[model samples]
Target: MANELMIFAVITALLALIFRFTSLIVNSRRNRKKAVAFFHPYTNDGGGGERVLWCAVKAIQEESPDLDCVVYTGDHDASPQSLMDRALDRFGVKLLYQPKVVHLCKRKWIEETTYPHFTMIGQSLGSVYLSWEALCKFTPLYYFDTSGYAFTYPLARVFGCKVICYTHYPTISLDMLSRVRQRSSSYNNDALIAKSVWLSRCKIIYYTLFSWMYGIVGSCAHLAMVNSSWTKAHIEQLWGIPDRIKRVYPPCDTSGLQALPLERSTETPIIISVAQFRPEKAHTLQLEAFSIAMKRLNGGKPKPKLQFVGSCRNKSDEARLQKLKNKAVELNVDGEVEFHKNLMYRDLVRLLGGAVAGIHSMTDEHFGISVVEFMAAGAIPIAHSSAGPKMDIVLDEDGQQTGFLACTIEEYSDAILRIIGMSETERLTMAAAARKRAKRFSEQRFYDDFRAAIRPIMCLPYRNSNDVISNRDTDEERVCTTLYTVCGAAISNLFEAIHKHCVRAVQRGESSSLSWLGLRRAEYGCFVKFSRLLQLNEFLYKVSKCGKIFCWSFST
Candidate 1:
């Protein structure tokens, strides 16, 4: 009796799922307005990622005014008007379209507090849950992730939304695996792992497994865009998707910076570092390097002053800034170091124009927009000798070095000393070259590349639109249907095999017919796999129920 009841409940649930899915298909065929939904938790954060989000939205709005845009944000305190104002004030970007903001309460799961240890794996799993929440709230024709959350792609696809991801940096890649395996004395490898053999082995295993999982998740995206050549290489290697990743340089406000006077005041050389106060930015290295450079210039030469201009997103960032100040005092360069947090756009432009050179110490920075801005403002750049600066930005087309690259504090000090000692004519020549290189990553170029990359996907007709279905969507639907059909057929074949084996065993007058089948292990494995499939189906059913409740609430 219990077995019969269980079977009945399973059948009923399956029937309900089928009914709901059929209803959704019918609803999709209706003439509804289509929109692209952008999933970014911290849209108001004044960072490069925010710049990409706003620019992409603006580009889409300008290019196609018919389609609407909706942004899923975690910033619930700010209204649409305030967000628009902040965007304009911080980045000089104007968003003509007022996108609907859907506040997500579960976004805290992605924050560092949720994962004080093992942040990478924790945030990744958290993003999957966040994506599910976004989907349950509203289903869009296209799902776009400006942030580096590739884990959301599969969830988007399961809901029949095309997935597009702009990967600022890959979460896991070969370089990360190599760093763990080799136990190198670099920022990528932990000091404990590098020192202990057992810890190093365990970390290597951890990174290798995570890399495989990352690749699997990354391959689910239909299209991927990266910010720099270094990012593009890593994405292509780890994403395991051929010809899906393209390079679209992040937008930089070059015109405004370029309009500033090229000639800087030589009375007191100002060395500026325009980056967020994050541990990865290596502000400590900048302080130590500046101290060493000052010591080198003590031979009857005026010391250059270092200015740290950056955005502070939260209390942690503010605390980091204070700690950096303390470090400067420890180095006895506090008198020469100045910290500027969240400077206005105009003030930042003015500072950049008056500065002689810019310094960046982040390792493997994925496309240094600040470095590009420094160049556009006629400040020669001295950046870390890896990633974006090494592969894309600082190199000249004619095989000339546009700026300086350093790996160590001493190297950074020597580079700064060399820049300080250079003739004004040489400095001007280098600045001109750097500015010319930066123009390639201008806002216009970014718009063009972004449009080209997304055009093929966005132009496809949505299911809810009155327009006829494009070949791409039709092909995708056919492929998805065939996949389901194939899976169903495989399950049927497995059951049939078990049935035939059981019949043959019973006909031979064997009491233990299950053992006679010689397929108990295979049958158990199949049952486990099928059970997982049912659990996934059940989860999707619950999500669909939530979506229905939301839709009903909005309609009433």
Candidate 2:
């Protein structure tokens, strides 16, 4: 009887392994056939959103060969040496860059280095044309909004393509509203009018308007994707778009972050921070907190050494880093604080592994990748109490905090001090908890979520007939087409004002003024030519916008 029982248990275990393996294979197969076209504004810069876009493309390509992952982007003239190019290769996604985008990148460089007044007419014009071309070519384009919008949306619609956007944050919020109002006060009286005018015309106004507009487009999509639940709710509430918003958190490439079991050589503590040198990141706060912590913890022994590792791309970022260095000296923590840039990934990871804790000072960091990187490397995270990092990722079993969350300078300082004073066992426990928590956000989870979201959209029926424009048409068809072209163009041009800088000064979001002014002259010319067109009243009614000609009814 004992021999038979042992044989039976071995057979059952074998069967279970087979079942699990089969399930994984089936899921992998399912994830592989979704064709997705990604629209990235700049082909050059390697920012966080760009990273997300590339990861999704690479995952799709690896798992599903038939799933066409076409990347439509503005050319940034970025070479293999360029940071973005390296990331793109690391993911294995093919790229399609437009000349206009390249020119835009060139113009940005010029604006940065040489001429401050470089309007970049070529860049803007190239963007519009490329967008128009992308719309005409690609069927279902997914827009990633790290770059500006005005050029991308209208073209996508003209071609009858669906758009899904991964918005980092809502452009218009309580924060932006206050800023717009404050700026509008400087404009000649008519505070409400000026505010409204600025809001409608300005960059922020355009951003907010485009976000809501894109939300409408996102709703129309077979799928609406976002990074966090916080962003999902904000999009739904603000846009009032009745769509299914799916949460697919982007992944961090944490291939080899497991503990190496190497001995840490330092007798004193080590705290390190890794982020781009930016004012918004509030690296100064980390320095301030560290200064206080070191002073309090100092007992005639060598104090903890703090390292700041990150690159400075812009002048403002470089300036901020310099300012922080100065402040660190003033606080008398100059000897403890060290700033280094452009460190290799392995080196950074090794540093993280040796560190007692990692510091993050950025407020409301949307889905903190660096914090997770630190966690994966077994660094206990001491982060600001912000939206993405606080609510989404850092949580432990039994409802305990995974690591420290601080808001005020004193609170931040105290948290660092407390961590420093922790017993070795307590520190180890916190590090373990952080690592466990970060496991959920691994590359596998990201791949699974993204695959599921994209699968349905890929299965959508290809309606080639409706999208194609034929030369022959009936009188009624001609009239409808005319109306569509005239009205569509008018509305699109009106909306394009949301992207212009002049409009950013006004607080009102995307006012009719810019649209109206543009159409006024066009309307007069159209009135003379309307008699020769196929549909007169039908054309007039559809094209007319408050006595101005609205041309968008053309069938393409």
Candidate 3:
């Protein structure tokens, strides 16, 4: 009996020590300088996402000049001046000041090759570790995630930072679940997995579980900014924080493109395709459609030259580009198809100036910035007939058709043929309308909307809230969230429901609102704050039900 008491005393002392240590990490929130840290692991990808990062940094610099801007990147060669120059030279976005860089070493963990089987969950969890490396090095007043890494937000909250993320698209969605259930082979679902019923069922279950965890972690963000209408809806449904979600269009470089003339040169009509060479972009589909279009011409009409222009982000992308070149050769349209990789803004503009139309074939693209760019450049877009293009961009402008939307390869080929057959007057008329429609997604509009969304959160106090709504957690507050929340019942998403329960319980005059330091006398024997719940899943559900005691609660 004496030994049992001694063991109990040791356990109590251990919990106290851990609680104090976690509190120090949580309470040490204030930085010497008021700074904003943008968590973007890959900064030199030269994609639309990278453009967004630079534009966002520039916007923040303008909004609050006193706040220092820092970019957490994995690129070893990246410097303040180099990134600034890339922004200007590549995307024509000029930064007011250089952002401080924090180099990350654990980037490999987030790479797709690291976990070939469970890539989605692998990368999601990997991002949490990467964020850990980033935040430990420099604790900022505001933690901004330009890249869509939802899993890292909870850890950032634990470090007492106000988390904000500009989500391009949801990490998981009903569409993914549907695709798996239907056994459809797409970018994420493997053809092999789709063929086997058992495999498909197993994957569906895995996705459902991951979706729940993703929703929980994603809710930790103080503000969630989405890029498109499609993106907004998915994030709203998935994260279950519709109140905090804001729909902001991505910054399209329309201002510069709008300056180009609508009239294409009398040379061969060029059809340009611009997007990163990722699997989902469907570069092969564009190539196949172009090949069919070329065959259909057969000396009857002038065959338009197809131009493939984009950047390769990694080895997989580089390999994909090479495979595309090989595919062009195999398709016998090698001579007709031209590949121009990583072209500068001026070069791309020059190509856009000569192009009669642009082709995009990615299905369910959240927001097609490239499609908008195509329209802004006076190129009638032939885009996929779903998501961003169909819902937002490729609609009637001033009572006239602005662009074409296609689903199948045959439909895309037909659109190409129609564009080639159009008279100069007809082409110019449509191009003019498309450009007018494109003006809505301009860089200035993004800056205005983005500034408005972040302003309220930037001014919020670093005070504790049971939900991941406000800002910093107090000394014991973070320990409860990180240790207990992770281990106990109020894991981010759990906090909001638990808080609401406690608030209702208190209003009923049943129980007092609780905190990490608060415990009901006699009924609760030990200082069992959430950071110490062993049977967290079971206990948390009871806590959510407002069962007598031990639930962490907040007034607001």
Candidate 4:
């Protein structure tokens, strides 16, 4: 009798669990709104990524008006109108209307402080948890992840929503694996792990496992839009979704910035460095290089001001910014250096108009929207000679020299000294070339590529033969050959006038030193699949031409 009672209880518990699971699936499927819900928690990050988010929302609004846009956010103060205003003020993106906001209580779980160790996997799992909360509260027909949280794709799938993600970069890559195997110490790989072989081996194993999981979850996305060729290559290698992955570069505010005069104010020439105060951004290199240049400047040359402008994401970022300020004081060049935190669009435009040159230093930057901005604003760019800037943005345009590229402190300092030495005519000529190249990354290009990439996936209504096929046609929605859905409204400008894009500056080593940038597949260390990038090196091996202060056209 006792055994029979126990069996009956077990059966009842199993039945209850199944019933609950079934009800959840049914409820989520039935209650979903026909809209695209963007999974972006930190809306006020004020980076190029956030700009992409607002632009994506705008693209959806202009193309399709039937579906409502919803943002899944951790920021408690967010409202429909506030987000809309931020889009316009912070990114210069004007939305058709206010987007619906879905706030999440479990945002702390995704915060860096929540997991001291294993932050990558921790934040990723936390994203899944946060996503669960988001889906449970308000399910949508389409789940669009603008923030590269690939881990949440499976959960979004479970909720029966079509998954689409705009991947800025792969969460884990072969470079990380190589870094572990080589015992290289960097932000992600600590010195302790690098020093101990056993720990390094254990970490390699961990990364290997994580990579596998990341690949699996990433492949779950129905459509993947990558921001650059570098990102596209990596995502294809990992997700193995070659057909679905589309390379649509991030949008740049070229039109707005293009209006800024190429002729600068003759006052103290400003050299602008725009980027977030993050470790990977390598802001210290820019400061160090600036000090070196100051020391080398001739007595007759006027002192140029080095302006560091960017946003702070968290306490760590603020601390880093403080450290940079303290470093400037230590270098005794504090008087020559300036720090501008969180400036608005109009103010940033004004600053860009006055700047003679801009700099960027981050390594392996995929595609630099900020680099495009500097070029658009007629500021000479001295960018890192790897990935995007080398392969895309800083290239010579129309057979004219566009900007400089460098890698080390010595190279960057030399570039700065060269810029100062150049005559006004020489500088303006290069700036004009850069401005022309910046047009390639304009917002219109992003809109066209974005719409084309998602057209088949969105499954919009067929266009009639009478419809206009021009790219500039705003009324294409009425007789739309293709359409995408996602949108929001403008509130009182929450960001006020705070919209500045980052353009991290660094220079390349000599030609021999840059040989590694063009490595063969087998020579690419742990990344043997890099054969696709072989042609990138062919673009140019820079040769000193006409003793000019700038490098020649990269892709013209």
Per-residue lDDT tens digits of candidate 3, residues 1-556? 2233244446546545655545444334433136899999999787889989999999999998989999999999999999889899999999998899999999998998899889999999899889888887897878899999999988787666778999988888898899999999998999999999999999999999999998998998889999988998888888999999999999999999999989886358889999998999999999999889888875767868999999988999999999999999999999989998999888998999889999999989999999999999999999999888888899998899999999999999999999998999999999999999999999999999999999999876655322332333544444444554444432434444443554455456543334232545323334333334544465443332221111222111
List clashing residue pairs in candidate 1: none
The model with the greatest TM-score is: 3
Q: Candidate 4: list runs displaced more than 4 Å.
A: 1-22, 460-556
For each candidate in the order shown, give its overall lDDT on alpha carbons.
0.78, 0.57, 0.82, 0.79
Model 1 spans > 4 angstroms off: 1-33, 185-188, 397-400, 464-556
Native-vs-model 1 lDDT? 0.78
Residues 1-556 of candidate 4 have per-residue lDDT tens digits of 2232244336435544644554564467557688889999998888998999999998988777888999998889999999999888877899999999999899998888899888889999999999989999998888999999999988777666778999998889888899999998887889999999999999999999999999999998989999888888889999998998999989999999999888886457789988888888888999999999999989988888999989998898999999999999999999999999988877788888888889999888878777889999999999999878888788878799899999999999999888888888999999989999999899999999999987777884422212211222444332222221110011102111111000011112122322435633234333223323423222111111110101111000
Candidate 3 has its poorest 10 consecutive residues by lDDT at: 547-556
Task: Give the C-alpha lDDT of model 4.
Answer: 0.79
> lDDT by residue for model 2 over 416-474, one digit each (tens)?
77777777777777777777788877777888988887676555665343222232245
TM-score of each: 0.81, 0.66, 0.82, 0.80
The C-alpha RMSD in Å for every predicted model, in order, reads 8.4, 19.9, 11.1, 23.3
TM-score of 1: 0.81
Best first by lDDT, ranked: 3, 4, 1, 2
Top lDDT prediction, candidate number: 3
